[model samples]
Target: MQKKVNWGILGLGQIAHKFVADLKLIPNATLHAVASTSGERAQNFAAQYDAVHYYGSYEEMMKCPDIDVVYIASRHPRHHENTLLCLKHKIPVLCEKPFAMNGVEVEEMIAASKSNQTFLMEALWTRFLPTTKKVLELIDDDVIGEITGVKADFGFKAKFDESGRLYNQNEGGGALLDIGIYPIFLALLLLGKPEEIKAIASIGKTNVDETCHMLFKYSNNRIANLHASILNETATEAFIYGTKGVIRINSRFHESTSVTLLLNDKEPKDIFFEFLGFGYRYEAEAVMEYLSKDVIEHPLMPHSFSVDLMELLDRVRKEAGIFYPTYDRV
Candidate 1:
């Protein structure tokens, strides 16, 4: 029998807790260690999850010989540095969404991973969801005929707490990098990278985007309409239009339970699939399968695709004059 891969978690935030809850669903992976900025928090996480070890600092946890892979769940602004540190330790990494603050940082991490022969991948959990996979298959089969457009939105009202991370500039709090990434990823998956892009956003007092409307033009003459916000809730749904039919995804495009298709002059067809909470386990399973084969990255979410997505985001951010402090580091 193959041995289980030992996993170390960096940052015990709310998302980390959700991921841990899903990690229990996989049999070939084991939670081995946890590192948090606070020793007290680390201890609490370790006790709650029964992690083998806890470290007050990430550097300490990265040095552990037993940890085969590290999951970086730090805040967006800190992802680049946190991932680089794990790469320096020669440990494989599965990082949270948005990859990094910009494309340059993602390139640097990719280079380091290649040089170190360590695996690295973005934890774009939606790409592996069952509904998404089936949708891709239908697109490939031309079930929707020639694809033409995509529409997706992810938005929710934010608490007015100025000190909260969602409203703090230093924390990289914004709709563009947070909820916006989902709509962007959906477009990328179906249309590949866009050839041209334009965006408009509502800037907040904290100098972060509270709402954004984006347009993507693909080389195949297809287009994507994407939107996100931190002020008001959206339908949280998606529609992929093609020449022959349309695919409508349910709320929370990332964790969809079913999809409906309507062909020209034909009745609407409904497709359903069962998935565990939020569909995070699919990504975990993909990682386990690829890691068992010693693959550095999964094809579904390749490093180049990540780089392209980040570059596109960089262009949009520049066009909108929305800059983060980490851009200087690039």
Candidate 2:
């Protein structure tokens, strides 16, 4: 018989609900507990998800002996402390992306995980998607030949809510840290770090970037054009161009399940991915699998990848002259 991996959710938010719905999709994965600031919300979520336990405070959930791992779904500013608290309690952590505002905080989180000998992984769901893996394989097989350029964008015309998370600098809100990371992740995953990064942003009234456009130049002469914005709407598509042909990832590429390949004078080939519950199941499955094997970090989306990605974000923010006021608060 296999031992079940019981999961404890530290914040009951939008993402937490999706993760809980997917928990039942994994074998031997149980929604053991959920925590929220409101006791009513925590109890309701527990009942809705069939969790065996629920707590009004994160500290209370951390002390639950039934939970094998803790998933931190708190806001960007709270990830570091939430993770550290879990680590000290000997619980592994799977933290949501924009990992912790910046790389310095990420380093400290990594250190805590190491010191406690508990597992910790940045919960970047894109890297674990079936579509993402297929896209990578196609590139590796030179399906499009020598890569020359890449273009991707993620944006939406978000309503003006200065106090809300998206536009509020005090809450670590900005286009670059929120949506720009998706495009940057694609570039780095496909082309590695670039020699030159040219970026500019439109700083909105709240002082956070409303839009950001980035250009990366590699030593191999390859270039990537990436854009992100919360002030305007975009197609949210990603395209890869090469010497032989091109490959296009359909709308909302970051969370998309379809990819199309085009070869010279040939009809386009489309590949589709089918997965469980909001497509977050794949990453959750990866975490459970690692825990069952007594492993610390996921090989596919390792700590180094998280660190490097944050380093890139840090550099991009610097170039764009965008800084969040939440850094000091975190």
Candidate 3:
């Protein structure tokens, strides 16, 4: 392999655009290929991202020898198939999060990766952000004392369109599988898998979750309160409280640039991190680092992490009466 890592992108959506921009930020990484169902869209994305190859057929791109790794940003329902395609070609994959429609799909993807001996990791961008790193650092130092609870909420008002992925059950539309995963991941990163989970959700006219709320109980007596919705606007922030102090994330905490520390009664101190492009570069860098080391998975967000996370999503959705297929919608 050359010093430069060649990347191929599937699905020319908004997230793919952001990821391509970050690909340019990494000196040793280059966007070499792109594919979309629409040839025009694929060509346009390739032109904009300086990709050398563009195809309307994902299979064609998978056969391209210039591509070393592929990023799958397709609709949630297609993640399993898209990942399998790359793994079949012995190409590594960095699949965008909500790894698949459910735990079943996630397990299959993991099996494919292991069976093919190819690299695979879910692209949960926030896990590699500067703010998250600092949060983990603070917690490790015990600056926040014994952790007791975590609270997070993410929501927005989206125009109702049942045909769109955001409201289509077949496309894996629902607050819990979409934005809800953010808060759940944050809680898991801090507290591990919960001992007990209670979740409630409001199913919209489209049979998708307009809103979802979850409470998790840990063996250590810690609990996490999380919420996600598309029916209304929310505070969209996160707070972690401990016996000694609290760590507060700014609004839109998942992608926020700053993390504030408020210990006991002391004045709040904010630490800021300025990032290039869309902050997806951090994850891209991590992937490159892992590849350079000949590793099949990233420790920060490994295959097990993706599996565990998907199981949590599965449990929450089942308890809330959500299903993956449109036909299964109640």
Best by lDDT: 3
The model with the greater TM-score, 2 or 3, is 3
Alpha-carbon local distance difference test for all models = 0.87, 0.89, 0.89
Q: Which runs of model 1 end up more than 4 angstroms from their true locations?
A: 328-330
Candidate 2 residue 261 Cα shift, in angstroms, is 0.5
Per-candidate alpha-carbon RMSD to the true structure: 1.3, 1.6, 1.8
lDDT of 2 by residue, 61-146 (tens): 88788788888998888898999999998899999988888899999999988888889999889888888999889989988999
Compose the digit string of candidate 1's lDDT tens values, residues 231-323: 998899999999999999988777898999988999998899988865777888787777777777889888998897787777777766666
Q: Sort by lDDT, best first: what order?
A: 3, 2, 1
TM-score of the candidate numbered 3? 0.97
Error in Å for residue 209 of model 1? 0.4
TM-scores of all candidate predictions against the true structure:
0.97, 0.96, 0.97
Query: In lDDT terms, how accurate is model 3?
Result: 0.89
Q: Output candidate 1 Cα RMSD.
A: 1.3
